[model samples]
Target chain A: MIFSSALIETAVNEFARMPGIGKKTALRLVLHLLKQEPAQVQQFSEAIARMRQQIRFCKLCHNVSDEEICSICASHSRNKTLVCVVENIRDVMAIENTQQYNGVYHVLGGIISPIDGIGPDQLNIHSLVERVQQQEISEVIMALSPTIEGDTTIYYLSKKLQGVPGNPVKITTIARGIAFGGELEYADEMTLARSITNRLPLENYMQK
Target chain B: MIFSSALIETAVNEFARMPGIGKKTALRLVLHLLKQEPAQVQQFSEAIARMRQQIRFCKLCHNVSDEEICSICASHSRNKTLVCVVENIRDVMAIENTQQYNGVYHVLGGIISPIDGIGPDQLNIHSLVERVQQQEISEVIMALSPTIEGDTTIYYLSKKLQGVPGNPVKITTIARGIAFGGELEYADEMTLARSITNRLPLENYMQK
Candidate 1:
C-alpha cells in the first residue's frame, strides 16, 4: 500500500481529532494545505500556535480572553450586575453573535457530569460565587444547556451562592432558552424556547 | 452578548478556512484545544505546522514524501515499469489500500477543470510525460475519477504520451473502480469494481 509522508499523516490525524472530521476529510484538508503556498500554511500553523500561546481564561469570568479579563468583563459600559453563566466559551460566542445580551458572562468550563468525573469543584464555581459576593451583582443568569448535567450544575451553584453574606446574591437561570436534552450551540438563533419561557423568580430560587 | 477573546477568535477563523468547517465547528474545535493541557495544544499546532515544513514532494512520483522520493517511488522492489497516474495524493492512498496494484504511482496534483480555470498546464502533466519519455516505462494507467474533468485529463495525457520510445508505452485507464458520479475517496474498499468491468482500451478511447 502507498503511504504518505509521516508529516502529512500527522497533520491528517490531527484534523481527524476534530469533532466530525474523518480520515478521508482529514486527508483532503492536509492535501489542500500541501497545495497552498508555503506562506499560507505557515500562517495557518502560526494562527493555531498563537491561539494557544496568546489566549487565556478571563480572571473574573473564566471565558477565553487575550488579556487577564475578557472584553465583556473589561468593558465598563456592560452591566456587571448581571452575569450570565454558561458551560463553555462556545456558548459565550453563541450569545455574542446574537448581540442581545448586554451583561457579562461566567464560563463553568463544563457541566456537572459525574459519569465524566466533572463536578462543581472541578469547575470555576468558586470564582463565580466570589464575583457575586464581591461585586454589586444583582442577578446571576444560568444559560447552561438543558441536559441533566446542566441542571445539576445549576442546582449545585445556586445552593453554594445562596450562603454568601451581605446582599445574599440573587440567582436565576435563563428561562429554558433551550429545549429538554437540546444543545445550546445547535439552537437556532431565533427559535430558542428558553429566552422567555423558563424564566423563574430569582428570589424564589434563593428561598428554595 | 458575550464575546470570546480575539486570539481565540483568530484561531477559530483559521480553522474555519478549511473546507466544510464553518464558524461553529471551528469554535468547537478551538474550545476543545483550550480545554486540553498546554502541551497537548502545542503538539496539535506543531503537528500541523510541521506537516507543511517537514513534508516534501517525491521527485519521481510527485506524491507527498518525507525524503527526496516517496516510499512507493523509492522502493526498488515495486513494479518500476508500470506507472499509475492519478489526480491527487488521496487517489494514491485509495489504490494503495486495495493491495491489488503493485505498481508505482504519479500524482498529477489535480485534473483539468476548465470551469475552475484549471488546464493541463496547471497540473503535473508535463512531468508525467517527461517520465514516460525518459524512463523504461511500459503502461500509464489513468486512475482518475469518471467526471468530465477526469475524462478531459485522460484524453489530454493519452494524446501527449503517444509514440514515446521504449517498451511501446500502453496508455490504459482504471476501468470503473469508481461508481458513476462517485468520489474516489468515498468508494468502498471491498466493493471496488474496476478490476473487471471498468477496463477499457486506450485505442478504443482514441477512437472516441
Candidate 2:
C-alpha cells in the first residue's frame, strides 16, 4: 500500500472508501486507470460525478429517474393499479429484467433495519402510503428481500395501507422458497419450512 | 443489465470498463456511490481524474512520481550504482514495502510479450540501456515476474546492456526458486527444478 505519488495515494484512498474494495484492490483499480488514455479517464470521472449530481428520484415511486417521474410510473402499458414495492432501485431493475411483471414499482429506498439505525420513517414509506391513498391502486405487491427487515416493512406498510378507511388495497408478498436450480438437501431449515408451508398445487408447479 | 437512469447507465459503463469488474459489480459500485453525499462523490470523482491527469513518471527510472524524478531516484541515501530493474511502478512499491534493499529502481513499464503485441521497443528498454551506459552503475538486478515474457525481456535487456563497450555493468537476476515458506511437496515442478539447480550454500541459506 506504499504509493510512490500523492495523486495515486489520494485516488486509491477514494476508491478504497467504496464498499467491498480494500487498499490492494483500490491500488489495482488506480493502476488500471493509469494505463488508460487521459481522455478516457476524464470521461469516467465525469460520468460518475454527473450521475451523483444529476440523478433524480421519481416523484411517484422514489425510483431513480432522469425526469420528475420514473419511466415505470409514467408508462401507460404497465399496470398502474398493481404496484410492486422493492427495497431499492437495483431491485426495480432486477424485476424489470425478469420481464414477467407488467406492474409499476415503488422503491422503498431501504428496509426497516433497527440494527442499522434505518427505520420506517427514513424510508419512502410516507410517500408510498400517500401514493396508495391518492390513486385507485387495486393491489400492492411487496417484492422486498426475504429477510426479517423485509417482513417488518411489509407488515408496517400493510397495516398503513389498510388503515385508509374504505380503501381495501389487496396486499401480497413475493413467494419465498428454494431457488430453481438449488439442491433440496442444501436448503436451510427456514426455507424448507416455508417451501413446505407454501407448497404449490402439483398442476400449478408443472405449469411454472 | 437494464438501467432506469441514463446517468446511472453511463456511470455503470465507466466502472464496468475496469479490469475484473463485471456489469453487476459495476452497478453495485454505482449504487454505493449514489448513497454517498454529493460533495463526497464529487471528491471521489475529482481525485481519480486528477490522479490520471497530474501524475508524472520519474524521468530517471519511469516510476510514478509527482515530480520529474521519483523519491527513490532523488534520494542520496540510496545507492546510485545498484539499480533494481522492475516491470512496473507497482513492482517498485512491492519491493519498497519489503524495506530490504537500499538501491534505486528502473521501471520497464511492461514485459516483452508477442501475443499481447508488446515488445522490447514498446517498453522502456532503450532508456534503461542508456541509463546504464551514462551513469556509474556497477550492478543491475532484474526483479521482473518469473514468466516467459519476463525472461525474454531480461535476455533482451542483458544483451543491450553488454553491447555497450567498456561499460562492464555486472548483470544479475532476482533468484528463481521455491518461496521461503512454501511446502516442498506442493512446489511446482519448474520451481522445484530451479531450486535444485541453484542450490545455495548452507551458510548463505541459514543467514537468509
Candidate 3:
C-alpha cells in the first residue's frame, strides 16, 4: 500500500520482511508502535536488537542461551542421557511449557527440507552424532514434527547413531496421532488409523 | 509459552503488544527474526526506532510527512481551496491511491467515540474548522468511514464550521451504500435500503 511518508514506508517494508506479515498488517503494526509511548517504542526496538546482538547458542545442546551453555544443558536435575530432538527453539519451548518431560533438548535448527535447499549438512547433525558418541546417552528421543522432513531427519539420525562404533544408543520417536482430549470421530483418517495401530494395552493405561 | 531465554521472552512480549498478534504469533515472528542474518535484523530494528524518533506530521493537513507541509498541500497543481476530511493518514493514502480527487486532505487523527472516551477535543476538528476560515476553502468533503462515530464527527464539524464567521463553505459527505462492483443481494439490509432511497436520476448516471 502507498504511504504518505518514506519513514513509514521503510518501517512497513521491514515488518513485511517477516514470514506471514503482509503490507496491510505491517502498516497496522507500525501504526500501533507509533501510538505507543516513546520509551516503550525505544524498549521494543532495543529488545530486538539486544537479543539479536547478545544472544548465544548453547555449545552442547545448540539451544538459544545467554551464556555458553543453556540452563537445560547446565542443570543436573534434567536427564542429560535422554535428549529430545526438535526442529527449532520454539518446539523446545513448547515441550518445556508442557512440563511433561524433564529431559534436555537438542535443537536441529531446522529439518532436512530439500525443497528449501536445507540439507542435513546445513543442520547441527554432526554435533548431535558427536554428542551421542562422546556422552553415555541411554536414549535419544526424536520429537520433531510429524512431517516427511521430520521423518527423514529421524531416519538419518538413527543410522548415524548406529555408526557411532561403541555403545548402542536407543533412538525413539515421539508418539503421533490423536492428541489428548481430541475426539476420535473428529480426527483425520490417517491420524485415527495411526492411533488405532499404536494403541496401548488397557492395563498399561490403568498403570499410568 | 515457556522460553529458556529471557531475551527471547522479552522480544516476544514486545511483539505481542501489537494489534491482532497473539503470544504464539509473536513467538513465531521473534524466532523468524532470530533465524535471519545479524545485519538484516539490525536494519529491521533500526528502521523502526528511527521512524518513531524522526517521523513528522504535516503542519497544514496533519498527514504523516517528512516535511513541514505534506506533498499534497505543497503541490501547486492541486486544489488548495478544497479539502477532504478523513479519519487518519491511511484514509488519506487510500484516497490518494485512487487518483480521483485533486483536493488537499485534512486528517482528523481519529473519529469521535464516547465509548472509547474520545471526544471532539481529542481529534483535529478544530484545525479543520480554522483552516476553512483562514483559507479560501469553498467546499469540505467528509470522507470518513460509514460508522456511527464517523457520522457524529461529521455532524459536530458541520455545526462547528457554521459557527465560523464570514464566508460560508459548503459541506458534503462522500456517497455511501453499495460499492461499484458489490452485489445488491450480498449487501446488508441497511445499505441496500439506503441505496434504493438515494437513487440518482437516470440522466445523472448516464452522464457520469
Candidate 4:
C-alpha cells in the first residue's frame, strides 16, 4: 500500500514484520496508534522494548522471567518434583490458566520438527535432563502438542532421562482423547480410536 | 492468563488494546518479539513511537503528511479542481492504490454516526467546506462508504457547500453496485437491486 508519510510507512512496516499481520492489518494497527495520545503510544512502545530487552529466560525451565529463575521455579507452594514439559512459553501460560497443574514448566522453545530443521539439540533438553538428575524430581509430564513431532520429542526425552545415573524419573504424558464438549461423530478417526482404546472407567472419570 | 513476567504482561496488554486483537493473539505477538534481536525490537518500538510523535496532518486536505500540504495536494499532475471526500486516511490510500482517480482528496476523519456520538462537528467537515468555497474546484466526489451514516454525512456536507457564495460546484457520489468478483446469486437484495438500477451502458463500461 502507498503511505502518505514515510513515518507511517516505517511504522506499518515494523508491525507487518509480525508473523500473522499483513500490510492491511499493519496499516490498521498504525492508524489505531495514530489515533491514540502520543503518551499512550509511547507507553506501548516502551513496554514492548522493555519486555524484549530486560526479559530473561529461567535457567531451569527456559520460560520467560524477569529474573534468573522464573516464578514457577521459585515458588514454594508449587510441586518442584513435578515438571510439565511444554512446547513454548504460551503453552505454560495456557496450562497455568487452567489452574489444574500445580507443577513447574519446562518450555522446549519448540517441538522437534525435522521438516523445519529443529532437533532435540536445539531445544532446552539438556537443562531439563540435568534438572531431573540433580533434583529429587518424581515425575516429568510431557505436555507438548499432540503431533508426530511432540511424540518424537517425548520419546527422545524419555530415552535420555532413562540413561541418567539415578532412580528412573517417572515419565508420563498428558492424555490424548476426544476433548470435552467435542461430539463423538465429529472426532477424527485417530482420536476416536485412541479414546476407545484408552477408555476410562466411570469412577476414574468422575473422580478426576 | 497468568504471566510469569510483568514486562511481558504489560506488552501483551498493550497489543490486546488494539481492535480485533485478543489476549491470545497479543501473547503470540509478544512471544514473537521476544525471539527477535534486541536492536530489531528496539527499531520496531522506535518506529511506532516516532510515527505517533512526529506525524502531521495536511493543513489543506487533512491527509497524513510529513509537510503542511500532503503530496497529493502539492502534486502538479493531480486535478486540483476535482476533490474526492473520504471517511479516513485509509480510504485515501485505498483510492490511491486503484490509481484510477487523478483528483486530490479531503479526509473527513469519520462519517456522521449518531449512535457512536460522532457528528459533523467531530469531523473535518468545516475545513472541507471552506476548501470548496475558497478554491476553484469544479467537482466534488462523495466517495464515502455505502452506509446510512455515510449518506447522512454526504447530505450534510452538500447542504453546507451549496451555501458557498460563488460559482456552484457540481456534487456526485461514487457508484454503488455489485463487486466484480462477487457471485450475483449470493449478493443481498439491496445491492443486487441497486446494481441493476445503476447499471452502466456497454460503451461507458468499456471506456472506463
Candidate 5:
C-alpha cells in the first residue's frame, strides 16, 4: 500500500511509460539512478532535456540537426542532386549507416496513412515537390518502408511529379531491400542485400 | 564516416552508457525524443532531474525517501519493534509489495562481498547496531540474499549484536526463499514460498 518516495515513484512511472519497461524494470532503473553519483543523474536529466532544445529539424532535408541545415544537406561533398525521401529521421540514420548512398535525405515525418488520418498534407510532400522543382535535383529516391501506406505515398508522389518541365527528375525507390510487409528497420543483412541488387529502374514503370 | 549531428550523437552516447543499452538502442531512444514534442522531452528530463534533487536517503533507515523518514518507518500502524534488515532499498520495496510483513526495514546499502572489496564497514552495519541498541526493537529479520556474502554479513551482525546487554534482540533470517548461488532478485515463486516458510531462529546458533 505504502510506496517508496514520491519523487522516486514519479521517475519510475515515467520510465514505465516507455515501450518495453515494466514496473520492476522501472524500479531497477530508478534504484540504479539512486546509486549513481549525483552528477551522473544531473547529466542524464540535462541531456534528455537538452535533446530537443539543442536539436531541430533541418530546414532543407528535415533530418535532425542543431542548426538550420543538417550536416548532410550542408555538405558540399554529398550529391545534392540525388535526394532520398524517407519516412522519418530514424530512416535517414539507417540509410546513412549503410554508407552506400552519397546523396542527401528528405524526411517525410510519416507515411500517408488515411486510416490514421495522416494525409499527404500532414507529411512534408509539398516541400519535397518544391525542392525537386526549385533545386537542380536529377533523382529523387523513395527509401520508405514497403508498407501499403509507404506505397501509397510513393504512387501519389510519382503521379504528382510526372512530366515536370526542367530535366525531368528521375523518381526511384530503393529496391525493396525489405520483404513484403516487413519494416525497413528490421530487415536482415542478406534480405537487404538482394533488395538492393534487384532495384528495378523507376524509368521502366514510366514507359509502361 | 560522417556521423549524425554532434549534439544528437553525444546525447545518444550518453544514453548508451546505461546498463544493457547499446549504441543502436541509444540512437533509437534519442530519435524517439527528437520526434516527441519539446514539452514532453522537457517533462521527461525534468522528472529525472527533480527525482535526484527532491529524493534523499531516509536518515533513520537509509531507504530512499522524500522526507526525513521513509513511509514504512514513519507509519504509526506498522510494527515498530520488528525490523527487517535488507541488502538494499529494492528489497525493502519488494517485501512491502507482498503486503505480508508489517515490520519496519533497515537497508544495509549492500551485502558483504570481499571479492568486490566490500567489507562490513562499507555497509550501514554500525547504524543497524546503534538502531538495535537505542530503539525498543525485539526482532531483527535478515532478508539478505542466500549467498555466501549474505551469510557472512548475517553472521557478523548476529555476532556483534549478541555482545550487547539489555533487551537481547532476537535475530532471524528470511527462510532461504532463495536457492544456493541464486540471487535474491531472481528467486522464483515456489522457491520464495519455501524460503519464507523455512526461516530459522538465530538464537539457536548463539549458544554455540
Candidate 6:
C-alpha cells in the first residue's frame, strides 16, 4: 500500500518482516503502537533490541538464558540424571507447564532437517553428548517430535551415546499414540499403528 | 510460561501486548528474532524507532506524512475542489490503492465513538469542517465504514456544513450492501434491505 509517509511505510515494512505478519496486520500493529505514549513505544523497541543483544545460551543445556547455567539445570530439587531432550526452549516451557515431570531439560535448538541444510552438527547434539559423558546422568529422554528430522537426531544421539565408553546413559523416547480423550476412529494411521505396537499392559491401561 | 531469561520474558511480554498476538505466537516471534544476526535485529529495532520519532501529520487534512502537506493534497493533478473524508490514514491508503479517485483526502483520526471515550472534539472533525468552509471544495465524499459511529460522524458533519453561510458543498456517502461476487442469500438483512432501497439504475451499474 502506498502510504503518505515514508516513516509509516518503513515501520510497516519492518513489522511485516516478522513470520506470519502480513501487510494489513503489520499496519494495524504499527498504528496501534503509534497511538501509545512515546515512552511505551520506546520500551517496546528497547525490549526487543536488548533481548537480542544481551541474551545468552546456557552453557550446559543450550537453552536461552541470562546466566551461565539455566535455572532448570542448576536446581537441586529437579532430577539432573533424567534430562528431557527437546527441539527448543519452547518445548522445555511446554513440559514445565505440565508439571508432570521433575527432570531437567536439554534443548537441542533444532532438529536434524536434511532438506533444510540442518544436521546434528547444526544442533546442540555435541554438547548434549559431552554433558552425558561428563555428568552423572543416568537417562536421556528423546522428547523430539515424531518427524523425520526428530527421529534421525534421536537415532544419531543413541548411537553416539552407545559408543562413549563411560557414557552408559539409558535413552528412551516419549510415548506416541492416541492422545487423551481421542477416539480410536479419529486417530491417524501412524499413531494407531504405534499405539498398537507399544500397547500398554491391560492392567496398567485399565488403571487410569 | 517460565522463561529462563528476563530479556526473553520482557520481549515476549512486549510482543504479546500487540492486538492479535498471544503468548505462544509472541514466543515464536522472539525465538525467530533470536536466530537472526544481531545487526538484522538492530535494523528491525531502528525501523520502528525512526518511524515513530520522525513521523509527521499533514496540517490541513490530518493525514500522516513526512511534511506539513501530504503528497495527495499538494499534487496539482488531483482535484482540489473534491475531498474524500475517511476515518484514518489506513483508509486513505485503501482508497489510493483503488486507482479510481483523483481527489485529495481529509483523514479524521477516528470516528465519534462515545463508549470508547472518543468524540468529535477528539477527532480532526473541526479542521475538516473549517476546510470545507475556507477552501473551494465543491464536493465532500464520506468514504467511511457502514457502522454506527461512521453514520453519526457523517450526520454531524453534514449539519455543521449546512450552517456555513458561503460553503455550498454537496455531501455524498459511498455505496453499501452486498460486496462484489457476494451471494444475495448470504447478505445480512439490513444490508439486503439497504441494497434494494438504494438500488442503482441498471444502466449506471452495468455500463462500466
Error of 6 at A23 (Å): 1.0
Best by TM-score: 2
Candidate 2 residue-wise lDDT, B106-148, digit = tens: 9988899999999778988888888887889999999989988
Model 3 residue A130 lDDT score: 92
Query: Tens digit of lDDT per residue, candidate 6, span B103-130?
Result: 9999888898999999889988888888
Whole-model Cα lDDT of every candidate shown, in order: 0.81, 0.91, 0.90, 0.92, 0.83, 0.88
Give the least accurate 10-residue stretch of model 6 chain B, judged by summed lDDT. Answer: B160-169
lDDT of 4 at B7: 93
Score candidate 4 by DockQ: 0.81
Model 4, which residues run further than 4 Å from truth?
Answer: A185-201, B177-202
Per-residue accuracy of model 4 over A44-139 as CA lDDT, tens digit each: 999999999999999889999999999989999999999899998888888988988898988889989999999888999999989988999999
lDDT of 6 by residue, A73-146 (tens): 78889888898999988898888888788988888888888899997788888888788888899998999999
Stretches off by above 4 angstroms in model 1 are A177-208, B113-115, B165-167, B177-208
Clash pairs detected, candidate 5: B175-B195, B176-B195, B177-B195
Considering just chain B, what TM-score does every model have? 0.81, 0.93, 0.90, 0.93, 0.84, 0.93
Q: In DockQ, how does model 5 score against the reference complex?
A: 0.53
TM-score of each: 0.80, 0.93, 0.92, 0.90, 0.85, 0.91
From the highest DockQ down, the ranking of the candidates is 2, 4, 3, 6, 1, 5
Q: Is the docking of candidate 3 incorrect, acceptable, medium or high quality?
A: medium
Model 3 chain A scores worst on lDDT over the 10 consecutive residues at A1-10
The interface RMSD values of the models, given in order, are 2.2, 0.8, 0.9, 0.8, 2.1, 1.1
Better of 2 and 3 by TM-score: 2
Q: Which candidate do you rate higher for lDDT, 2 or 6?
A: 2
DockQ of each two-chain model: 0.55, 0.86, 0.79, 0.81, 0.53, 0.76
Over the stretch A1-208, how does candidate 2's per-residue lDDT look in tens digits? Answer: 6777999999999999988899999999999999999999999999999999999999998999999988888888988999999998889999999989999998888899999999888999998888888898999999988888888888998989999877599999999999999999999999999999999999998988
Tell me the tens digit of each residue's lDDT in model 5 across A96-144. 8778889999999899999999999999988888888889998889988
Chain B TM-score, candidate 3? Answer: 0.90
Cα lDDT of model 5 by residue, B53-155, tens digit: 7887888899988888888789999999999999888788789888888889999989999999999999999998998889999999999887789889989
- Enumerate clash totals for all models, in the order shown: 9, 0, 0, 0, 3, 0
